[model samples]
Target chain A: MAVNELGDHLRQGHPLPCGRLVEDVFDDLDRGRIDDHGRTCVHCATARRSLTTLMEATRALVDDPAEPPPNLLDRIMQAVRAEGRRGEALPLVPIDDTGAAVVPDLGPVDISRQAVAAVVRYAADTVDGVRARSCRVTVDDADVGALRIEMTLSLRYGAGPANELVETVRARIGSALHGQVGVRAGAVDLEIVDVWPEEGP
Target chain B: MTTPDLDHIGGHPGDGPGDDRLVTQIRVAEVAAAAARSTPGVAHLQQGLWGLVQQLGAEAWTRVTGRPRPDTAGTEVAVRVDPVTGAVTVTVDVMLVVDGRRPAAVVAGDVQRRIGGAVYAAFGVAPGRVSVHITDVAVPG
Candidate 1:
C-alpha cells in the first residue's frame, strides 16, 4: 500500500517520487535480491521507469562537458566591445517616435517549428552517451499546426551507458524545446542509426 | 612613436585583401599533413590532415623505413599530431598488396600500439593521452 502511494506520485510527476520502499525495491532488483513482490507489484514497474528516466537525465547532465563552438568567444567579445561604446546601457534601443510612427507589439512571434528543432538538436547533443547524427523537424499544417521532430542517434557501443542514452536524449530534448523554444513538440521520434565504438578506432 | 589610425592599427598588415582565411587554414592543414607524412605508412590521410595527425601519429613513412616490405605482407600506418595538445595517434591503412585479408580493427590496434610506442620513443610522451581517429579502411580486392 505504501509502495502504491509512491507509484502514484511518480506517475503524476511529483518531486521525490521514490520513497524508502521504492529505493529498497530497486536495490533488491539490482542485486537480484528481490524474491516475489517486485514482479507481482505494479508499483515496481512504474517506479523503475520513473527512477530510470530521472537517473538517466541526471547522468547526461554530469557527462556532457563538450565545450561550445570556439567561435562563440569571438562573437561574445565583439558584442561586449560594441556594448561598451554604446553607453546608453539600455537592453534595446527604442526607435525615434514621430506622429505617423506605428509600433507593433510582437507577443513572442509564435515560436517556429525550426526554433524548436534547434533547441532539440542542442539538448540532444548535450545528453551524455548519445551522439545526434542527424535531425529533421516536420510541421503538419492542420487546423492547428503540429510539430514532429525525428532524431537519429549514434549509440556508443560496448557499455550499458548507451542503454540510458535514449531516455536522456528524449527527456532533455523535450524539456529544452518546451522551455526554451516555447513550442509543444508533439512527438520526438528517435532512430538508433548506428552504434559507434565508445572509443573511436 | 606617432599615433597610428585605429582602423589601420587594428587591421593586420600581414593580411592582404587577397589573403583568404583559406591560406591560414591551408597552412595549419599542411602542418597536420607534414606531421602525418613524417609517420610510417599512411596511404591516404584525410583533408584535415592536422586533426587526424594530432589524433593519430606520424607513421606514414613506414614504406620509406623499409620495415615490412611493401611488396610483401605489410601495413601502412598514418599518424596525426594535434598541434594544440601535442598528442599523436596512429592508424594503419591496410593495402590490398598486403593481403587486404587483415582486419582493419586488428591493424588499427597494432598501429595504435606501434604509434604510441614510436611517439613515446621519439617525443618522450605517453601514448594513452593521445586520441586516435580511424578515418579510413583499405580492403584488398
Candidate 2:
C-alpha cells in the first residue's frame, strides 16, 4: 500500500487488522522499525502517537475500581473555575505598560476594529492603487474566541502596478498581526472598499 | 528467459489496493478548484495544476541532470476525529499553480480557502483547520 494511503487510514483512525498493514505501518513505526518512508510518514506517526495515548488513558480509566474516583465533582468544578480564571486573566500581554493600550492580551488581538485599521493602514499605504476610507472590525464573542474583523478601504490608483499594492497590503497586515498583535487575523476583507481613479476629481 | 504472461504472481488480488491520502488530497484540491471556479467571482480553473507543474519540473530536472528523479510530490490528506474534543481536522497538501504574473501567496491563500470550503461541503463536519502546502508553479510552455 502507498504510504499516503496508509497515512489516510491512520488519519481516519480506521482500525487496520493486525498484520503487515498494522505491524508494518503502525506498530513497526511505534517499535522503531520506521524506514525512510516510515520516517517521512507524518500521518502514521501522529495517529500512532494519538492512538497510543488514548489507549493508555483508556486502560488507566478501566483499571480503576467500579466506583468513580472520589471528589470527581469537586475536581470538575475546580477545573472549570481554573479555566475561567485563565480566560479572565488573558496571557498574551507579557508586559502591562500603563501607557500602552491593552487590546485584550489573549494571544494575538482577535481581529478587531483596531487590528483591521492597522492592517488597512499598512496595506493601503504600501500598495500603489489604494487608500483607506474607513475600516470596521467586527468582534464576534461566542463559544469560539476572537472577533470577526471586517475592514472597508477606499482605494485611489497610482500610476504604478495594481496587484503589488494589494499584495503588499495583504502581506503587511498579515505580518503585523502575526508579529506584533500575536493574534491570527481571520479574514482581511478588502472591500475595494471604494475605488477612486487617480485622474478622477 | 522473458517473464511469463500467463498469470502474475501476487498475493490476494481481491484484497484490493489500499487508499492513498496524497491522491485523495490531489482529488480534494481538484474539487476545491472546481468549487472556486463555480463560485461567483473566481477567475481560474486549474485544478491540481501545481502538482502537475512540479511533476513536470522534476521530470525535466532528472532528464537534464542525468540523475534519478527525486519524488517531489508526496503529500497526503486525512480526516481524523479527536477523541477528546470530537472535532475533526482535515489535513492535506495543497499545490498552488500561480500564473507567473500572479503572486504565489495569493494563489496559496485562494487554494487554501477554496479547499477549506470544499471539505466542509463534502464532510458534514467542519474541519478544525486546513493546512496547505504549495508544491510547484506552472508556467506556460
Candidate 3:
C-alpha cells in the first residue's frame, strides 16, 4: 500500500511513531522483510512506501542526472539565506493593562531580531543625511526584554552637523522600536562608519 | 499520493503523537496557518532555512518521481500530544513576514487571535501556546 504523504516529521534522523527510526524501517524494506510491528503498523507501512518511492527517484536522478530548473539556483540561494532566522527570537514586549496589546495566554510572541533590525534601519534611514548600514541587537539577561542596539550608519559629508544627525537617528530608532514594535530600546549606539559626498555618485 | 495533511504542517519526532491525534494537530495547524496568513498585515508565512529545505525536498521528490505535486507546501507549526493523558497542546510557532507598513503589535495580536480562534473553532480546543514569530518585515520596494 502507498501513502500520498511526505511525513516532514520523518526526516533523516526522525523516528516513526511506531518507535523505529525510518532508516531501520528502510533496512527492513531493503531486506524485503519486516518484523511484526512493522508489518502491522500503519505509520511504518506509510514510511515504507514513501521510502521506496524516494529511493527509486534518487536512483533515477543518479543515473540520468536530469537538468535542474533554471530557477533552482535562485531557490537554493533563498533557502540558504537566514531570512526567516535572521536573529534570535525576541518576545514581543508586554504592554501595560491599559495599553493596546492583547496580553496573556497568547503564548510566547517572538519577533525575529533581524526583522526588528529592519524596522530600526528603516527608522534611522528616515533621518535626513543619514543612511543605516547595519544594525545588531542584543537583550540583556538581567534587564530582560530591554534591547541594546548598535547601529552602523553612513552620513553625508555636508548633512548639517554630525552630532545632530546622530541624535536624530538615535531618537528615530528608539521611537520605532517602542512605538511600532512595542519593544523598548535600552541603549542605542550609533557609529559614523563612512561619510559620503553630498553630490550624487 | 493523498493530499498532504497540510502543505506545510508536520509533527515533532520525539513527542510521537498517535495517528489520530497527529491528524487532529495537523488539522489545527492548517486552520491556524490559514487564519494567520489571511490576517491583515501578514505578507506570508515565514520559511526558515529548515522549513525551506523540507519544502524543497518534498517538491523535488514529486517532480523527480512525476508524482502529484502537493496542493500546498510545508506549514510551520508544532503539535504535541500527551501519550498517557492524550492531552493535546498546539504550538503555532510561526515565522511570518509582515508588511513593514503595519504596526507590529496590532499585526501580531491579530495573528494570535485568528489562529487561536481558528483552532478552537475546528477542534473545540484552544491552542495552549500560539507562538507568533515575526521573522521578517517586507519593506515596500
Candidate 3 C-alpha lDDT tens digits along A53-78 = 77998787678665767887776555
- Over B1-141, each residue of candidate 3 has an lDDT whose tens digit, in order, gives 112232134433432323343344445656777888898888887555566666676667777766543322225555554534545556676667778656666678888888888877766667777777676777644
TM-score of chain A of each: 0.41, 0.35, 0.71
RMSD of each: 32.2, 20.9, 7.3
Better of 1 and 3 by lDDT: 3
TM-score for each of the candidates: 0.26, 0.27, 0.74
DockQ of 3: 0.33
Would candidate 3 be rated incorrect, acceptable, medium or high by CAPRI criteria? acceptable
Query: What's the residue-level lDDT of A88 in candidate 3?
Result: 61
Backbone clashes for every candidate come to 24, 8, 7
Q: Say which candidate scores most in lDDT.
A: 3
Interface Cα root-mean-square deviation for all models = 29.7, 19.3, 6.0
Candidates ranked by DockQ: 3, 2, 1
Candidate 3 deviant stretches above 4 angstroms: A1-12, A49-66, A83-87, A94-101, A140-144, A193-197, B1-29, B64-74, B80-83
- In candidate 1, position B116 carries an lDDT of 44
